[model samples]
Target chain A: MKRLVILAVLIVFCSSMAYGDAYRVSMRWSAKPGYLRLVLESGEEIIKTARVYHSYSLVKVEFQSEFSFDYENTPDAVDISHKGSSLFININGLKDVKVFRLADPSRLVIDAEIEKTANAKTVPEEPVKPYGLSDVVMVIDPGHGGYSMGLVGSDYKEKDIVLSIARSLRYTAGQAGAKVFLTRSTDKYVSIDERINSTYKKKPDVFISLHMSSSPDFVVYYAKMDTSIRSKDRYMLKYSQLGHLGDSVKLSRVMAEVLREKFKRKVRIISMPLPLLSSIGSAAITIELPDGKYFDYNASNRYALVNTILKGIGKYER
Target chain B: MKDNRYLTALISILFILVLAGGYIYLIRMHPPEIAMENKTEPSSQPVTKPGSEEHISIKLFFPEGHKLVMEEREIPRVFSQKKILREVIREFLKGPAGTGPFIMPEGVILLSVYIGSDGVAYIDLSEDLRRNFHGDAIDEYLLLKGIYESTISNIKINDVKILIDDKEVDTIGGHFYANRPLKQLVTQEIKFD
Candidate 1:
């Protein structure tokens, strides 16, 4: 009897060791325009089985296993459940709970907002305002710098070529009445995280990443949609992170078409999951210039490229 | 004395016959086993020269704008899959005779090709590919698409895993995600109205 009990205990221990440990969840909060964004960080992947819902003015995000919260009590997160494997946070005034995931140290983020029509007894009046390009903001980024010289061609370097173009673009875009911001003004090393953070700070209407290719041809690309996600999850993620994927695709298409029509250059538009463009909170695209040898740094050429992009953005208004 | 000499010669003949019989018995016993062992060893197929009458033609792909254009070339007909792949890549990297963009970087060299049972082709390229690439989205896309199209056209490959200097890179040109096995890009061709 004693031997059998010991064998059973050993089998249990081995099986548990083989499966490894479950995921632990940590939480943080940030302020958005009209709501609070609760971010949950997990060391392991947040699987498809994780559940999140709202009930009785409280947002409950439940996982299969228990976790610990290492965050201070914020004003947005009114209360939190400490029992069991569930997180019941009191979002009393907030409505419409949304959840999604981010890569590179996986995080399951949740966003909730206070609906404007929640307590309204009658239809609200719509306000119409004057429209101009003043509100439109464009953020341009030149790829690679510092130790990373990018691709060095026979005569010109990629970093120099792109920076010159981006500088030209900023000046030209100003003529079109759009506020322009460059991620790096000089030949400095800027990490992707810093670029993203800076772009987010500006809350720009569009983000364009400028780069040069080895081939003497131009190509445009939009952020590719992740097909692995379920339709529902994709919708939430697209809305939360990108805001409008349709706008991004349209922007890239228009930019490509405009470039092809004006410059007589062979241009192709593709969808790829480029981090700089994909993770930003605006319609974004990356424009790859022709090979270094073919790069034209003349004022007229840069002006033309900038004009083409501005024209493309004009179509977005219509 | 003559009978004694004849008896000695008979004994010598008997001794030689016994040795020969023993050798034959051992060979007969081990023949099947030795043959089976040789059969179980990996197969080595000889490469057929292009000049040979039985040589076959294989198509190689190159970048034409955004599309991959096919150009056929005759190579030594090698029966080994790995050998066939190596020859195909060697010819493909030599650039196509067609008047279009050069498919790869100027000094890029192919290190090796690994084909797995899961139909994934892992291509090892020299560091020149990553180092000399014109850090642009279109340039990287064209290079990768051309190589992928050429490889898939020449061989049966479901996915392509690209490795530069024996290490996987997050992005080839700081744009396209390349950490995972790349599938065929749909927008590789320009459609005319």
Candidate 2:
């Protein structure tokens, strides 16, 4: 009886060990206010590789292990195919994808922001008011604060420099008849999520992020639109969902011109991959000034810098 | 008999105290366990034994005065693409023999490299690369351009996706879009778009 019991226990243990790590992948999605959320629930952890084809506006995610798709349907992806051990999910009109994997429950969450044709930008041939910024709702975000000491010069930190500049700009821009909001007015640590959420919530018309860098030249960065159409597909260009890209580019150009006039040197305007600017859904740009050692921002100099930015924004408005 | 009972009670008290101490040491107040992230960090020595491995010549591009200067180097021949990439990246980080001021900061190591079936390579570098950025656009642009050019010249990969400390960051180079698939060839200076 003892031998029979021992053999039975050994057989059960071996079978359980053999089937330990096999799991099927179940996928489902739901609609949110501005974007859709895709949920991939699995018993096993996910190891994925994504390739973004900008011209096609499609993102393909490949999985390592061979798992059967237990769900029936999805909106963005159709005809889910398995090539050997790989499962590919092709998401169309994908603006950006933020993925999160939760522990305890063992599930993967994906937020997929889709590009819509309704978000196309219309830049007017001329400004509306041509005077003070009475109709502008602007948000000024200082780059770093608290312990994030951005760039260290001989005696000053980049955080302090940008904050002082931002504070001065707030005072000057507010005096010039613009309703301005600061993401951080003091020395505090703020996360990226908070910054994005605040900017998105406020629905500002123009957003300017200020910073100081060790770069020798003055630079302005605008948001890059991830979606693009094939060069031959001219008809598809109109339907492209380029939100805020046009206005951001125009604003960057305006700022570049203003800074060039003030500093009397070349100011570079480049498109960058800044999540803060991309998701703001408005005309957003980041202005990088030279290090503190080169450019001193005393009371008079601070006012001058603030006046320069205001001049740029005024140009952009009109 | 009384003495024997007292002795037994004292022994029980000591045993309970020992149990409490063990619990505190094992579970209550233990130090964090530090695990080695990458086991394949190249030592100063060659990957293989000196005379055992085959050698192949590769051209490495280093940032020299705003342009990438190609320097020929010989590396041990490895069977897999991942291994070969690791060797190449290690060599690139070591800088040129003449050492005319390499663009990258020191202590930057390649933690991991993963290449998917679609020929996209995910290269995870150490945190030093991200934290040591001094906000110089020229150095930033040249560093990435040189690394990408060197990798492409030796390998047949489609694109390279860079990750610092196993996480995707917004941008390392302030000018270019770091989040995008790095396929743009830098033939001329980075022009404003």
Best by DockQ: 1
The digit string of per-residue lDDT tens for model 2 on A1-318 reads 999999999999988665444445677777632366667666644533322222122334555555556677655222245565455444433457777676655666767665431111111222333336776889998876544456666555565567667766666666667878888765555555567778767788889988775655688987554444355552332222145688888999999998989888668787654556766777888898887777764445565677788889988998
True contacts kept of each: 0.28, 0.24
Instruction: State the local distance difference test value for candidate 2.
Output: 0.65
- Give lDDT tens digits, candidate 2, residues B13-109: 9999999999887754533211111222333122353465677666788887647899878886765567667777889999987948876778999
- List per-prediction Cα lDDT, in the order shown: 0.65, 0.65
DockQ per model, Cα = 0.16, 0.12
Best by TM-score: 2
Residue A22, model 2: lDDT of 44
Measured on C-alpha atoms, candidate 1 has an lDDT of 0.65
Report lDDT (Cα) of residue B115, candidate 2.
Answer: 65
Q: Which residue pairs does candidate 2 place in steric collision?
A: A127-A318
